[model samples]
Target: MNNPTNSKNPADVVVIGAGIVGLAHAALAVGRGLTVTVIERDDRAVGASIRNFGHCCITAQSGELYDLAQSSRGHWLYFAERAGFWASEAGALVVARNDVELQVLRELAGRREAGQVTVLRAEETTAQLRTAQGTPDPAILGGAMLRDDLRVDPRTTVGKLAAWLQEQGVDFLWRTSAVGFDDGAVHTNRGTVYGRRTIVCVGHDVDYLFPSVSKEHIVERCTLQMSRAAQPAGLTLGPAVLTATSMLRYDAFTEMPSAIELSRTVDSGLQAIGANVMFTQHPDGSLILGDSHTYQHTAAPFLSENTTDLINAEIGALLGMPLEITERWQGIYASSPNGPLLVKEVQPGVTAVSVTSGVGMTVSFGLAERTLNSLFESVHSHRGSS
Candidate 1:
């Protein structure tokens, strides 16, 4: 549809979706002196970006993803300062309670170039856990301290970032849906808007615009469950926390030689259901805890108490006490069998990007930088050849 109210002059870039991925592209484009207009179906960002644990588990990533996460951390801190949001560079503590789990930590520490991970002695690890008002399990052999991770309040970070972008001159078209796109214009339900380039960062809604590309890439949905626990009096978590079960989830640790045995010793049900427990404290003195992964074409809009019980039991074993759950929720994100992220050109001037894993918050900014660089480089190359 055409509307006279829509901007007649094409913007430098038009972004679809206002989640972290879309916001990241808008922030980068505007920072580079490009005008940006972002369109979102919802009035506000209420997606995986805000529904996550807000943990930038940089140290737990591997290979290219790890490097992207490290770069994304810099952007997170930069925005956090100006956005007036709460963010912590306190890092993370991955606790190990058995010999096999301890072995995994030791192996990971040996590969320090991968991350700033250090293995801590059992007593030291337990002492650290005690600081957070919980006694560590007596069986805890040791733990690894990842010194490069970050934590933020996901519930607030997205809103703050969006607001900051708005103040920076980025136009946000909230409650507008991009139905389709061509070489130079996006067709939305509201109107047609032209842009030199268009980027789609719709987290998991593949069917909205590029259903064909989404299917060809084997994109699917991953559902997870999370909960918040009331903080204990006088307790402060020094850093985000992870238990042995988390070892089976994070790639940095799972690739270690010791992980095989550690996985074997873990509960089969936990592995079968893809359950992992991680803890991060919030400004309101509540702990954000989660989560289990279930993959499918579409996730059921229902919470499974059995999954919650499994998560609580596993995390309780690590803390030596059960937490009082205050809130429970679920999150779904785009996933792929190929990898954590997928970037493909849906058309000449339209690009589709999805954080096909749950690490969107950790790596979105970095991915945006890389994507924009490639986009502009291609444009320059084509112009020169022509």
Candidate 2:
């Protein structure tokens, strides 16, 4: 048995947090031939990794962020094939409930590149999905569009990925909370361990790890509501759904002017309906729907129904057809102020990284690898300078 405490640093690199982003970093560090050790606060892999809808979006993703998202999606598919990973290529559909949403579709269409997102007219969208119906009110002037997004079971995916990492010889420590640390060592609840360098990835719980940086860094925790339903297979509508409210809020559609306006231009009908649905499926055959964003410096107790009611309305607005309700749950993700993400050194050897924004399940792997590279590269550069 190896003792990090005894060795004063048994691992060359120590990563805190075992969430998808942290695990991705562990995997890439292992691949880079570094003696890697991972520490997690929870006994089991939890956090946003297992709590999200698991929609791997690509099309309509704007700026350099698309590159990482594209690469991450590839990694998911690779793991699926290897681990007999359960997944569905059900695709996605963005429904425009108003003229603003329709404008968003047209803008996304004009900008779509290899990401595989496409804009479809009302008839075209109906032709593709065969489920969407009823013409929009002339005042609404909305339609549905197509996006090549994949949905996966975060619960299943995180577990399978954990298994794969162990198979590949990556070291792990569960229920090990890190109280404090810098580059030379990572001090956790289990004991004080050493490493040549360290990376902090506390997610929305950054306040616990890097208290000093938490004040300056624009990282905050966002709590959201989610629910599952026994919607018919035909009710899936063939793809995922991002409502106009979502189109307005999410950059993938809003990066373009028209999409932004549609997002901003609200209709009382939708407001009355509380439309903010982003629909995707799970391997368990349950539909994943929701989300309302509420940020805080500290974690909040799992309570409140306003977000749930609003999310359900969003779900209902898109999947208006009849469906059976199954379960309700809550989740939290890290939200960065803007830009792709920032991974920089807080001190000489201590590095901090957070992709709290963009709900990056779409790019966790690639982002992890990239973050790992920066950490080690800094170590190398430091050595060369010394």
Candidate 3:
């Protein structure tokens, strides 16, 4: 494993998985002047990293997640510039249909600092919807704009970031599966790769590599259905659109006083599906709509049309028109009743970092930053003691 082959061999850091989480760690490692080797099981990231609305739902996070989301916001933009990828500061629009939902938005806006969350009038909110039909949803009372949120093209960001990381001298082992981890080393099917430290960001597949750790954390898979709809005629959306169900999903909004009432107002069918009804428009003008959460120990390899129909119908009503589904996929990420994050030391010099929730896109870079800081500080302190 320690055998030297190239200049980048025996890297300073070895990262497992090439999804956004892994790539983020690799990119940040490079930023710290560390030689990084990334191991991916596939030729490209085809997982939860690419299967999202690309919204960095920043303002909706609370407590530690909020801090991390804010930190991640900067890095997402930083790397986007360095990597020449498309990222927008378009923020997020939370459309409140009824007064209960509008109350939730207003409460959330009041809690945040001025300009961070802006409560909008019904006409202003409806203007942002850009409906292609006769009229927007009449139920739109008012809404709020989450000013710190961001959007990127999930389909392309990972690939471009990976490519740019390679250009920065980070080595990528695509199609290489990491089977095991030892102190300062990663054992893959191809061969053992040595590094000073190893970080595993394998998302839900953490169970596949470290079963005990996965079980100890009560890690399971949370699968959701997402779809892409063709662009509506003459419609262009900037900010990611979130709805009443979204208020139920994010912590910041849920903590509001009106959240319970808002939840009660949500349709029972939506609640049954665990829907977080939201959409973001891609550069191509196609809208990415999704998603309903279903958690289990093992993810079923099937998509429920009934679930999709219910969710899409809800989104269609919000948009005042029916959606033309172009593509659909099931996104599976690590989930736990324990917490939204699992960052544990599996072995000496080996750490496993998994966002045990769906905010992977929102917190990837910031989480990586914290992990690296801890790793480096521990090393510095140990060397000084010795």
Candidate 4:
């Protein structure tokens, strides 16, 4: 087992919160040959990192996020291979059940390079669903194939990555809660862990440690409902499936010219739930379906049956089959009205990074790369003058 206590020797970088964001930072630091230590309150990750679809929603981002997601794609594959995690490059399939939805897909496809986003015919889209009865939903108009997206098993990827990082000589202080931070030390419940730099990545709990910074960024906890169901009959879905509701959520799709019309055309029931009717299949033949968005300063612990039903029903109708839910949970992530990211140097040698956009999985590695690159450059420049 990896060490559960802080190392006496100071590390080059110390990361708080062992979710994807923290793990990504530790991984990048290790790659840079920096000594690192990761602090986690839990023995294992049980946060938004594990309770997610694991879909790196790459192709559906716009502008800065799109560039970051594209960079994240390579790093995801790189770590997956070396860390021995399961990652699939099957991409994503956006299902359009109506003409307006199809138009949005067409517009997006046209804007992208060839093969990056391929608008598919109804029959082609149906084939990608892999339904048991070999039938397509009557509402299926057409869809688009997003070629750059990737998937990892959210339940296991972080655990595997954490183990791999430990193997790479990154120290881990599990069940260690970080209570405070200074220029070169993290004051944990157990004791202080020294490091040259400290990165706080506590996700939605940012307010707990840095209330002012969290409040400054207008950060809120975005709670989403998700469920897992046994695979229907012979269903063998590869690509992550997205629906018209998803089009309304992702910036790339929302930016399309037909997006407004598509929005107007969506069912009121779906809009009521703030649904992003999407699903990704696990290797175990189970389907991970989600989700509905609701933001608040403090997330409600309750999961609404009505919300889950709305999302699951939509997914079932798209698959041409009913679902038998085996598990259900609420996913909480950092969100903000101000921006998608909160990368602020809260104090000297201490930075707090949070993906306030709920795209942590999509932008994890890339954001870490940008953060570390800037830090490294600044460090080198400071040393050069000193």
What is the C-alpha local distance difference test score of each model?
A: 0.84, 0.66, 0.89, 0.90
Better of 1 and 4 by lDDT: 4
Per-prediction TM-score: 0.94, 0.85, 0.95, 0.96
- Which candidate model has the greater lDDT, 1 or 2? 1
Query: Higher-TM-score candidate among 2 and 3?
Result: 3
Task: Kindly list the per-residue Cα lDDT of model 3 for residues 151-222, writing each as its tens digit.
Answer: 999999999999999999999888888898778778788778899999999999999989999999999999
Off by over 4 Å in 1: 1-7, 131-134, 378-386
Candidate rank order under lDDT:
4, 3, 1, 2
When 2 and 3 are scored with lDDT, the better candidate is 3
User: Candidate 1, residues 234-262: lDDT per residue as tens digits?
Assistant: 55786888887788878998899989897
Give Cα distance to truth, residue 28, candidate 4, Å: 0.8
Tens-digit lDDT track for model 2 on 106-173?
76676665445555666555443333442222232345444456677787777787778778777777
Clashes of each: 0, 8, 0, 0
Off by over 4 Å in 2: 1-9, 123-148, 236-238, 267-275, 338-340, 377-386
Task: Please identify which of the two predictions, 1 or 3, would achieve the higher TM-score against the true structure.
Answer: 3
Sliding window of 10 residues with minimal summed lDDT for model 2: 377-386
List candidate 4 stretches off by more than 4 Å: 1-8, 378-386
**Higher-ranked by lDDT: 2 or 4:** 4
